[model samples]
Target chain A: MTGHIYIIGMGPGYKEMMTDEAYQAMKNADVIVGYTVYIDLVKEHFPDKEFFTTPMRQEVERCKACYDFAKDGKIVAFICSGDAGVYGMAAPMYELLPEYESQNITADDITVIPGVTAAISGAAQLGAPINHDFCVISLSDLLTPWETIERRLIAAIQGDFAIAIYNPSSKKRHDYLEKACQIMLDAGTDKNRACGYVENIGREGTKTVVCTLEELKNAQVNMFTTVFVGNSKSEIIQGKLVTKRGYEI
Target chain B: MTGHIYIIGMGPGYKEMMTDEAYQAMKNADVIVGYTVYIDLVKEHFPDKEFFTTPMRQEVERCKACYDFAKDGKIVAFICSGDAGVYGMAAPMYELLPEYESQNITADDITVIPGVTAAISGAAQLGAPINHDFCVISLSDLLTPWETIERRLIAAIQGDFAIAIYNPSSKKRHDYLEKACQIMLDAGTDKNRACGYVENIGREGTKTVVCTLEELKNAQVNMFTTVFVGNSKSEIIQGKLVTKRGYEI
Candidate 1:
């Protein structure tokens, strides 16, 4: 009586960028559940699959709805824009296991199919800024406290790890990325360290900009943008950001 | 005339796991370059295409050979095991650009195509262990000093980020992973924290093991294994390791 619930990453919104594992999971799903935007991305590929969507900020509700569908013996595919494990639906789905256990649902019924994440996809467009040890932190204060985010930025800078900032800016929070960049500068990081941002990666209207930390502090960004801040060894070689692995020549 | 040199990630060593973007790049290339093991992964698919591989320690010489192919006005595809941006060929290719530029080569001739990295792909098989902020560090001290690696591990532990350890062990570095676990234990981290390792992801002989940190300290690992160590908030729920993302009711 157990049904499958696959958590799939759509991978930056291009069909070509998706892995066959994710594509096959969705293609075989009896029902599809996701945010409104993500559901639209794969609608064309599975025209006959039952689809359900919820708007932004309704993650818990959407995940619950997907669980109910799976509990009823229908194979479900839950979609996320990037890799489902990274700041995506995988955590939320795991958090909901206790609520659905009464319906005989269990974590064993779920599977996560990984895909290309924004940090790697965006880094590819801007050149290679994440060649060594790196850390990823979301700049949004919606779930995590601002103080925690600030401390992580300072620690990452001090540790000299290349950083990939997710949810860098949104409508209500305009100055968070600026404040984060300031923390790096205050940590004695070079103002000219390679910094770049990519918007709408692998989708239409995809735009990318590469600059210094000084310039990125005031650059225009939105929720769609993912930022990359290079480490001390990162440099611009032939007009592209590249961080060497320190291999002895 | 300058020809294209595409830096591609083969994505965990399976045709089904690779993105269409990377596949097409290699399919259209006049010559392909990679390490011997990775080159063998796609050799059957491209029997007609010319391929060149270098043994383990000759990365520089291998990259030089790739540049030579592209500089001679032939399209070349340089393959990396995981995403090219993460501890892959993108940085080395960029570093070699100067040496190739003396042959009238330039950065404009190169393009990076991203794919699923080991951290993400490996996490998928083990459940959602990287559902929050995380850092990735390679334990191998071949290129990077062990002292620097130790410092980053401590910082990542203190920051409470989920950690992905790449190149966890090799022939000469058998005890490196054990040493890293001891640092986490000394930092007062829970000795029973959930940890797991995945080997040969998406290919033959794929194996995964999940256990507590204390067990991981003595676990057998090799260069092909990618390790995941959970943070303070991660736990085992229904036999799956999951890091909850503070969802509000």
Candidate 2:
């Protein structure tokens, strides 16, 4: 009997931040599969359940192994931080299913449960930086070409859309975030436009800083930080970043 | 003494879809305030609690009343569907606070709680349509200029970013969705590109339909419907919309 594969988002590694549906899905799974970091977040909640994890850059292998576990009659839950559907593990699960069809893995064998994404969660901590229209871009060039990412960044900046940036920097890609800020600056975004960045969102050691576009270009950021650059209407009020809805005030 | 104001997102109106923080915020409130529809979603869950609701287009009036309740020593929970900080109540709450300063209302009087937004919730049901870079644009032109919204739409389409459209149609605006589709098609988006729409998401009578970009222009849509248009890398696999990450596949 082929068991089901559940794709669940753990929502920033906090039990209080996760939806009840996500929590119940984890409890019902006979086994769990995820990246080593995300798996560690839920390990205490399900201490006795079986776990299989892979490090970064091993997403394809992790997805294939999840299908194998489900095919062997184990109800498997695959986890991702933030929403599984957003820059997370859900698409890979569907993208690789054709290769595992011969093992009796079918469309009915999978379910995708949504969770609060970092863009939304981080915006909340910054006090409504995403109050109006916005776009999200990741600066990581591990899989996608930098040229393509640059074009999207330029378009979002030029359009004056509030932009949320994910995977801004890493040890190897130290200057990508700086290049992105330069693009925005060159696009005529006001130097005083509000910007906010949050590190370790919804977890211990979480830190937030609200500044201006010019200041953010020099602010300390890393892969764990989710950065928000507000639009033309954004302002700093009472130490918080607030993007007013585009309307007559 | 002024009490606190909690700007909370109810997360698509289902108990199972809400986070523990949102649920606790509601339970701890002295009274709840929202649009009539969102207030009704949580009414049964908190039958003994007081609720204050206003009709549509009375947002300014609603925000004023919430502050009044909070200033009068009542712990007020201002509710919004989806994330309060995302096109919901959080911004207006801040925008109106300056006017209520004489009433003892201050920035420190409020807190914003994040919840799963419609883009993430609807994408999960459609099978990962926002797996990569994406933008969200609301089709309603009540406050924002139509010119600004159109420019953003064109930019997103030209950038090959997946787009989620909120408030796609209303009784007075029937042809806006068609006009938006024309913009995408004119920008060289393939007519066969995958598109999906959901009505009353995360609530009773939820209905979803997946189709091509050409077909979506004529699809039945309403104010409550959330529409998704895939990027260049999006495809329909096994009758579900799947947007592959920008990697060599």
Candidate 3:
């Protein structure tokens, strides 16, 4: 019988923000597995527990190690930042686990504890950009086709939805944010919308900028940045950004 | 001179999950104000401080009170669950403050700290339903026109963006989710997309369900629930919900 595999979200950086349940869950684990960055994040909590750290893009092997250890009745945990389910390691591990189970390995007990993500953290930095309805899309086409991303951008603008843009740009793929804003402009008026960019959320050197859609075209953005574009109701008042709920004041 | 008001997001109901800086900032405040529920959430930490609580709908007044108190050069902190900038109390307060300041009652200083929101918490509970690019929308049209909400839904689906739906329905508006689902179906194949509904994300009595877009329409849902609709690459695998990042396995 496999002991449980607990995939926990450490949440954006700081441990104090971690839930008691998540902290206790991680503390009770026999072996903890995660990316080196995440392992470094919670290493102080479990100085004596076995630690397994993998390089970036090697989540498959890291998860297999966790599942294999858990199969032998070890309490194993795979950790990720800001909710394991949001562009983190949990789903990929879950997807690959079933294939390993056919090799006479049992895979059953698995629980995912939620954590905060960058978009919310970024939204918290900016004032209520997501107060109403919103959408989040990654501008990176590393795994997703650009064409598909373009379609989503066009649709989001047409819907007049507040949008959280993730993986906006990288060294390999520059101009994704510019293109996204261009698409939004094509769908609607550039002056009527509000946009915000939050970079290095929850970490030192974090910076946030609130501007218009046209301003986003020239904003310095990167993978660490999460961008928000407001709907028709979003506004900038006295340098404070707001997306009105359209309620009677 | 008016002391500043720091509106902080405590993240999803966990002290350990609260950012170190946000925790320190709150600890240094002279006065803290929030809804009774949020005050209760962080009660143990500020047992000796001056704290005030209000009913849910009284956010505007509560914020005003905080601002008034802060004008005495006292550091006042307003606490919000998840990120203060989301559907929390920050925006309404920001909107109301400038008007008060114009009357020569100088507005208190305001600084917003980001915290994790329910969408990430919901995603964490459901196992990576928001891994790819996604969008978040609130179904409540209390402040927004239903027509605007409808347009956003259609755009999100057309973009094939995974969407997080907040405030799905309330007492008076029970048909919002149904109508939103109908709009999604109209834009994409109901059978092709995956959706997850998570309720009471950080609190007890949390429930999560993963199903096809068609099944989501029939799922027992409510205003407390946060719904995630997967993009084209999203799928329900062996009861575990996932959205592919398109990276090589």
Candidate 4:
């Protein structure tokens, strides 16, 4: 017999934003494991379940904890913010599955419940900035190289796809957004191209801004901000950003 | 008094896939309106609510009807599959709001609740093919020009980012997916690159296929399919596709 693991995306730290599938998984799980921040998001709702958490930068250990709990025949819920598959813990968990199996402990059943990721949820606040083709790039360089992020930014701008920027700025990467905007501008993008960002999406102190590329370049932002550089067709209508489906409109 | 309008993304046509907010909006609305196919997906669950529908290619008429119902001070729910803001009725409805106000009937309150979109939802079925950066391009040239879509595909490939394609093929555009693969191949994409497609996502007769770019070029896909071409780091691990966050992994 094997234990079951549920890698669930909790969706922007709000219960209302989570899918019934994800909620049911949480209810079915006997144990929940996550980063402390994500676990605290759901601790109130599932007070009866055994909870385990790690602070940030402890992803490897977090995955190991979930496997250990699952190996003990507990229905383990490995939770993460946003869609579990997108920069969440699902891939890493799946990557480590073989390691656990080599110890004669198996978690043969793993279910991934998708949730509203930041790019899609943040776009809800700014109207429809991703109505057409769009790309999502992270400004954080912790896992990815800065050069790769820069090239992706240039490609997104050159492709004329509306770009959603995750982790736009952190304490160490305060100037990354400016560098990205410069790459876009260097690509001959119009300085007044429509742009916007949503800070702390679906959380307390949520804020939104709609401006041109020039304004976004100088805008104050933090790691929680989901920024967007709109396409050539993006516009500010009624103070909201919208990228229409067709130019004929 | 202006009535409220709730534009909700029903999320992959599954009750379990819908968000609590979308379900709540469905329960609170006096009536629900949508495309005929999408309405049928939720008709049984909320059989007591009044429902209105329009056939395909009648988006303008449908948006007008939602405004008309809202003007009558009814809690109108405008529902669509997947995230409402992404190629759904929200923008068009918002775009038409001013016109409805010209008739001296306004909907001053409209809440846009985001749900899981197909790209992210479909990714769950195929594992984590979007772990890092990704772009979504629809091959349907009905709304956007074909040349523009081709450029986006090339850019996504050149950027070395995973690409999720929406509306990959329709009755009139059955060859579009093939054309997209050819564009990638022409732009120096390896023929054996990891790629996948999910058919009828989160619905009956759901199917997932993981294969090389060469296989995808000739794969039989319909309108219901969501396709993807992986980045350089993408791989098939235990028959699951995953584009890892970092190459070192």
TM-score of each: 0.97, 0.97, 0.87, 0.97
lDDT against the true structure, per candidate, is 0.89, 0.89, 0.77, 0.87
Interface RMSD of each: 1.2, 1.5, 2.7, 2.0
Angstrom error of the Cα, residue B176, model 4: value is: 1.2
- Candidate 1, residues A139-177, lDDT tens digits: the string is 988888888888788878877899999999988999888
The residue pairs that clash in candidate 2, if any, are none
TM-score of candidate 1's A chain against the true A chain: 0.97
Q: Residue A154 in model 2: shift from native, Å?
A: 0.9
The two-chain DockQ for each candidate, comma-separated, is 0.75, 0.73, 0.52, 0.63
What lDDT, from 0 to 1, does candidate 4 have?
0.87
lDDT of 2 at A244: 87
Give the better candidate number (2 or 4) by lDDT: 2
Q: What share of the true interface contacts does candidate 2 keep?
A: 0.72
Per residue, candidate 3 scores C-alpha lDDT tens digits across A132-189 of 6677777877677889888888877777767778888899878888888888888765
| TM-score, prediction 3 | 0.87
What DockQ would candidate 2 receive versus the native complex? 0.73
**Residues A1-249 of candidate 2: C-alpha lDDT, one tens digit per residue:** 569988998898789899999999989998899999999999999999899999988888888888888878999899999999999888888888788778777878898988989999898888889999999999999888998998998899867899999999999988888888888888787888899999999899989899988988888799999999999888877777888875343
Ranking of all predicted structures according to DockQ, beginning with the best and ending with the worst: 1, 2, 4, 3
- Which 10-residue span in candidate 2 chain B carries the lowest summed lDDT? B240-249
**Candidate 3 lDDT, tens digit per residue, B1-249?**
557788888876767656665677779998888889888888899788888888977767787787777767778788888778777777787677677675444322677777667777777677777777777788877666778878778777777777888888788877778778888888765665878888887777988888888888777788778898887778777666788766566
Model 3 chain A poorest ten-residue lDDT run? A99-108
I-RMSD for candidate 4: 2.0
Compared with the true structure, what per-residue lDDT tens digits does model 4 show for residues B1-249? 367888898999889999999999999999999999999999999978899999998888888888788778888899989999888877776677667666665434677889889899988888888888999998988878899999999999989999999998888888989999999999999999999999999999999999999999999999999998889988887667888876333
